[model samples]
Target: MSEAYDLFVIGGGINGAGIARDAAGRGMKVLLVEKDDLASHTSSASTKLVHGGLRYLEQFEFRLVGESLREREVLLANAPHIIWPLRFVLPHVKGMRPKWMLQLGLAIYDRLGGKKTLPGSHRLDLRKAPHQAILQDSLKSGFEYADCWVEDSRLVVLTAMDAEARGATVLTRTECTALERHADSWTATLEGDGGKRTIEAACVVNAAGPWVDTVARTALGSGTPAHLRLVKGSHIIVPRAYPGDHAYIFQQPDKRIVFAIPYERDFTLIGTTDMLYEGDLDRVEISAEERAYLREAVTRYFRSGVTEEDIVSTYAGVRPLYEDKAASNSTVTRDYVFEVEAEGGAPILSVYGGKITTYRKLAEHALEKLAGHIDVPGEGWTADAPLPGGDMKDGDFAHFLWEASERHPWIPPEMLLRLARAYGTRLDIVVGEASSLEGLGEYLGGDLYEAELTYLATHEYARSAEDVLWRRSKLALHLPQDAILAVGAWFDARREAATP
Candidate 1:
């Protein structure tokens, strides 16, 4: 008989990774499997905000809003490098929701969340310099509120890294092919580049995001698994539409809201159409209609019009919202629902419809549900714990950056800042004893160097250039085509040389 694990988790997105980290911290034996790179899908494709869904207040989802808002503070503490404060400017327009209504909504929004270190909502003068320069002349006033920007994909990777460090086994590019449940435990077959293997676990977490229902049915027989409503949300990246760090929230004629956010220091990110999705899940892309919709949506509020020629990149992902049969796709609950099957055998907890902001709470709640079925050795302690690189002195990232500059005088300021954001306190491991850029390694592309690539491969489970360029970081957007190809070639040559 093989050694049994206390928990077996499927998927490597935020929820799965969060669960793995939580379970491992509890001293439970855990094995987490991902079919592809971490955050390769919906988790990475988010609007990248650690925020309470302000619009949810209109849907009477006060509980969800409060929970998400509380988690934002928790996440900011856990991963300060990848998550930081972002202010949003919502301009008040005529023939729309009245200013009183907006004020009421913002007031409720400000209070629903717990004690906030972030600044509260206040009125904005759109006719002022930066706001006036960006907005249409007709727009006179607006409201400014606080949310946060996050490197969404990096959050997943860091969670997985923390899980592994805490004594859990994290297997990326590994698929849970088969699951056999017994009265006391579950036997799962996993396949990957490592071939095939089987493992036993007392409990199972089906956190496969979009494939949640499919995993449930596959594991528990075809007996009417939980229904999932996959809504497709797409975003377009254009040259920076505004000069300020603040983002914009535009209310559409159809009552839907679209956000135009500053992205990558050089681009504006406009997104998210909430259309009912019924297409290929793996190959989701911004459709011509969605692009036109987003372009028109932003152009309506901006003094400068956006055209197709300005689009630099585009991406789309399917959100696995728990089906509620709402009047419209946008009305569907962003809240998560769990279905635990433990009546006749080992428990299998299937997670459905969770957002990035509330993943930590969701994981804590999942463990609470499993408490009756298994021996939980650890308590819920993730709320205040810092992720791998987040434990800077006094949790102040700015101070940490200044200290890093003093320590590594030979490194370029831009490169140091980028590394500081990506690795946080762990930048020490990447820099090592190198006193200069030449000692660090050959420059691959952008700020990517051989030393950084080695660190990613050895520590972060990065296998290919795509994992480094896209998921691990957004270097793909900054690096030229030839530079990207060189990175790919470098990885290929190294792998070929190591092959027998």
Candidate 2:
């Protein structure tokens, strides 16, 4: 007989993690299972902004924009280390959106959201040095607005960490093969490396992301009236296009907007083409057309002219948007919708079409939808609580970095900063009283050390070298091919040593 949990969340993306964390904090016995690594899909492949969706306002998605804008502040307050304010430079192209229209839109955006800590929008002189030197000569004006940059994947991991700390069971690389509904509960069969197990739960949350429909049809064995529009969005990483910390949001002649963001300290991240995705879900890749489209989008504004050869790496993800019957893929609503179906008293809530910016609110609403069916001991509490290492004193990242340096004087400044930014107050756990770099164990490569790898494996659910090198940290971009190979060998050796 398996122990019955109050809630079983199916998925490991931001929404599932957030829901698990929230439910656990509310005193509900929760279990969350992910089919793959956390945020291995859409959540990690975002433009990585915590903005109000300025473009969404053009489509009259005022409610979504307002909620997202408010959530930006909430997320920033809760996880200051991974979420911080970022300024955007929107260069005004001739015969595109008029300058007054841009200013009016920004003003409405500023007013729609409640009180904010980040600065409001204003005009920009693109003819100046940093802007003029990089942008095309014809672009002499622009608008600067406030948004935020996020460590998107880390946010998902931290949420899961918080859920675990709050006594929630989080299983990664585990698949929910089938779910049997009863008059009072659900018996779920979960398969993982350790093998299969049946877990009983009072309810289920199908936050399966791209596989939401499949989970509903196969696992739950229910066919409700709902459809998903899979849209593939691709991004390209190139050598830093300009010498500034700020990012650019350029308007194209086709009325679509593309962003050029500063990434990985030495690369400029440009993205995202929205095309109807009808291909295999597991094998999403950047198409040549998308690559060329993005290059042209950036080249139109930059004097240096972006080209295909400049691309260092590319990534593509399929967004599981709710079927809104919109005219085109890009116009599909980013707002989330929940379909809660209960048969024989066992409820399954399916999440559809959500953005990274509004995940917290989505979780809150999810719990609200489960109110009468499940017993929640407490009200919403995640908004005020910091996620895992995010509890820097007063949420001041700069002060936290300084304090980290003061405590671990032996650690290198660059390494210490990276650790501080990534782990915040949790740096000491990884350092583990190590007084020197040598004390941290063998240097893996680049900034990676053996001690850090151990910490990731044991704490952050990193199973493969790719998990640590790419998703956990962008070391894949920094480390040489040989170094990456060495890291993989180290993982294999570690697993062998652990084998009994």
Tens digits of per-residue lDDT, candidate 2, 54-94, equal 99988899999999999999899889988888889998888
- Clashes in model 2: which pairs? none
lDDT (C-alpha, whole model) for all candidates: 0.91, 0.90
After superposition, the stretches of candidate 1 with alpha carbons farther than 4 Å from their true spots are: 1-3, 223-225
Error of 2 at 438 (Å): 0.1
In candidate 2, stretches whose alpha carbon ends up further than 4 angstroms from where it belongs are: 220-222
- Alpha carbon lDDT of residue 394, candidate 1? 70
* lDDT for each residue of candidate 1 in 271-342, tens digit (9 for 90 to 100): 889988888778888899999999999889998989999999998999999988898899899999998999
lDDT over C-alpha atoms for residue 241 of model 2:
92
Error of 2 at 361 (Å): 0.9
